[model samples]
Target: MKRWWATVPEIAEDVRDALAAGDDIHAIRMLMDGINALPAAQKAGTLDDALNAPDTTGDPRWDALLAGALRYRLHQIGEHAPSWTFKEPLEKGWWPFAYSPSDAYNDMAHTPAELMRLGIFLDEREFTQA
Candidate 1:
């Protein structure tokens, strides 16, 4: 299933670069802008698609990032509880949700390259701009 983040590679790269530069705020802002810039129909459809897609990818990192991105997006829309106050069921032995536990820990674990890969994977490759 295509995800909202998967549809915007350039924006994802920008966010990853910002994260590498130790500017998480900028990364989050870029993410927010990218989502907001999408047409309303696309945004709604993509969000639903991502949420309903089965967790076929067994990689914990991918799972964590995908879940985090979804949560972050929800937070932006004022749908998620305050400060990302939600706990997803854990796959036994998997690291706790990256964003939770602690901000510092989340940053340490989710490196720029990891985020870049997640972004690339999420991109649906359905449309191109020229």
Candidate 2:
């Protein structure tokens, strides 16, 4: 499979380097900056497209990037419009239930970045899980 990081722009190389160096803060900042630099309309549309797109690549890294981007956009939106809800999976192939951001993040995240990614399909977004 193609490496998702390789498909991203040059700025991603810098983020990847930060990640490899265990500087998650810097990496996240760069990621947020990259997302923020886009025009407001484009940023909203792009993020919506990314989040709603199907995950057919079957690549963990790709999923992580998608999820992380979605989370960051959602966070930006939430800053101005706080009324939002998310559906949380209850069981395998079972109906998902509504969850507040706080509860979902608490239950799903083990790191700040993970929380920033909203833990969407997290099991499929990590190398260790693969």
Candidate 3:
């Protein structure tokens, strides 16, 4: 929970709202950008590093699973091993990242990394159905 963007409640709420509003892709992007913009104290670069890295061999354990999932999806689509990176701007979320710390203290909190993983979950449910 102490990872870079894990403590941001506003981002979480926004993602929830976006999901409720039928805007899942928008929600995912908002979460990504919000985490990217956080200050150094609360920011964790693990996801961003793995996403932007030239090679994924250096990715941390947590990110490796999701990153592998992403790579697999890309391969299924006939793409290269590493697909183009995507991140939504903060405006896509309902609230700004500036208010996330306070929201984390008093409300549900989640990091961009958490939300992105949610994206993978939805994708799997929607696309991998038997």
Candidate 4:
């Protein structure tokens, strides 16, 4: 499978393509599946690269969401995230998806540790689901 962030060219293409297509979810799914397909030893490093990849998509909100999602993924695997993942500003917002108040309540109620720390409220299923 192709990597979503294997090189500067690839990251630029993938990130910009998704923005042009108005499909942040597809971009994130590409990221999730890309990481999921990697060997255990490679997953964290690839995720870190994806996290650090420049935001060519011109969507800082999406960039922040990527940070939140990748950090959460790292935590799920018991890996320490790249320290930069936390140091940068959160870019101001909640999870970048729409949900009902009840859904927000539920996510808040069952907070996943790392995302909670990042102040991103999302169901882990956002990444955990196939």
Q: Which candidate leads the pack in lDDT?
A: 4
Candidate 2 per-residue lDDT over residues 67-89, each given as its tens digit: 45444445645632112223232
Q: What are the per-residue Cα lDDT tens digits for candidate 3 across 1-130?
A: 4544432344455555665677745655654544343443223434433334322222122133234334444444444443433323222233222245675433224333323332322223222321
Query: For residues 73-115, could you state the per-residue lDDT of candidate 4 as single tens digits?
Result: 6666776666645535455537545478788887776656666
RMSDs, each prediction?
12.3, 11.9, 16.8, 4.1
* Better-scoring candidate (lDDT), 3 or 4: 4
Off by over 4 Å in 4: 1-15, 38-56, 87-91
Can you list the residue pairs that collide in candidate 2? Answer: none
Better model by TM-score, 2 or 4?
4
lDDT of 1 at 47: 41
TM-score of model number 2: 0.35
lDDT (0 to 1) per candidate:
0.42, 0.40, 0.38, 0.57
Clashing pairs in 3: 4-43, 4-44, 5-111, 29-88
* Candidate 4, residue 57: how far the Cα is off, in Å: 3.7
TM per candidate comes to 0.33, 0.35, 0.29, 0.64
